[model samples]
Target: MPAYVGAVQVINVSSSGVFHIGDVIQIRPISNTKTFSGAGSFNTGDGLAIYNQYSATNTLDNDGIDQGINFNL
Candidate 1:
């Protein structure tokens, strides 16, 4: 099995983007950054709120699933 495309038009690819017209085995996109705020303090929260701060490291991964069909092809 394979893929076929007639025509396509890609305008732009952002800082974290992937552009492919044909078959792709795997795509791993990662974004890591550091933030610097000059606010008075980090004392801001609501009833339904969470912590907000600059993370020293990004421990986020795109490992949501591991199926058999993906490798079958």
Candidate 2:
């Protein structure tokens, strides 16, 4: 079977800007935003929320917890 895709949007960002590998990018729909309609469905009004953090240690940012987990495990 073939894979299908819904709404596709391309955004051009600044190359000179300092963007970390784990950065969250959020996009809000304006008054004229449109959604995709057909075999697949797209929700434009909801907008898009991206979470870039992958490591639990990085997210927690606590050395005590990390030590506890390491000792317990």
Candidate 3:
């Protein structure tokens, strides 16, 4: 695949952004952005839940729900 360009105007590019102008073979760009408001927890369990503020994981290590229940009856 290829593209033909004459004139281009780029106002701004984010920190995780890329801009290129040329005849290229392959271009692979990856950007992983995460935003945390209250908290960021992974596989958390609370017995008696209180004022709750939780966040989920963006990785592959998390269980079913980022927050869980491990009860021993």
Candidate of highest lDDT: 1
lDDT tens string, model 1, 1-73? 5777887888999876878776777886555454554433465667645454754544455786534343332
Judged by whole-model lDDT over C-alpha atoms, candidate 3 comes out at: 0.58
How well is each residue in 2-72 modelled by candidate 3, as lDDT tens digits? 77798899999877577988777665555544454444234367774455566554554445544323331
| Collision count of model 2 | 0
- Number of the candidate with higher lDDT, 2 or 3: 3
Clashes of each: 0, 0, 0
Candidate 2, 57: how far from true, in Å?
45
The per-residue C-alpha lDDT of model 3 at residue 39 equals: 43
TM accuracy, model 1: 0.45
- TM-score against truth, every candidate: 0.45, 0.15, 0.32
> What is the C-alpha local distance difference test score of each model?
0.60, 0.39, 0.58
